[model samples]
Target: MSNCSFCQVIDETLRPGGIAIWLMKEAKEDIKYQVPFLLAVYLDENVYNGALNFNPWRWMEPENEEKRNRRTSPFYAPFGGGARFCPGAELARFYIALFFYYFETTYR
Candidate 1:
């Protein structure tokens, strides 16, 4: 995913809680809430070095790409994750790519 996509995922304040409401398994107290995964992880300094800053070049590093290949990588999901992954992920990416192509080619 591009840096724009990452930013969108991390900075979506409209969905302050998250994309979905989840209910936990049986416990002493019932808890239901939206787990804003990207936003939460993005705030953690230890996770992505200077995660607060927008550094597109970070994605180019071999270590970052390798982390992406791992299913457990916390920062890998631009379109959400697991069984509830977004259905429009591919279409969204295509549009973003198309826009980026034009922007990069046409910009001064």
Candidate 2:
């Protein structure tokens, strides 16, 4: 019941502070990351539900779209965000698309 990004790469042999793109505001009031923050927490249930369960239809629904608050709703941002966003994100997606396309054509 988890789709955690940190956990995903845990088996891939990523050492601590290896790919340090993920960052978030510190809860320590005045303190913040001088380098990169390693963990990001979501204190709501819906975000977890979105990832734990597979419901692709929610993404296409207008009702769900309007209710999507980043803090509580489910959204997939596999790569980190802003300046640290994965430069290979597009490349990864492209490879996935090609794999599916080839698989479908071959198997169809």
**Every model: Cα RMSD to truth:** 6.4, 9.8
Expressed as tens digits, the lDDT of each residue in 20-100 for candidate 1 is 333233457767655454666644666666766665555556766654431344555545667756788666656766776
Model 2 stretches with alpha carbons more than 4 Å out:
1-45, 48-50, 63-75
lDDT assessment of candidate 2: 0.40
Backbone clashes under 3 angstroms, per model:
0, 0
TM-score of 1: 0.57
Candidates in order have lDDT scores of: 0.51, 0.40
Highest lDDT against the true fold, candidate: 1
lDDT of 2 by residue, 3-99 (tens): 3332233211221122443545547576644754332322224433343333444434554443333223223334554565678855664565567
- Pick out the ten consecutive residues of candidate 2 with the lowest summed lDDT: 9-18
Candidate 1 wrong stretches, greater than 4 Å: 1-29, 32-37, 69-72
Question: Which residue pairs in model 1 clash with each other?
Answer: none
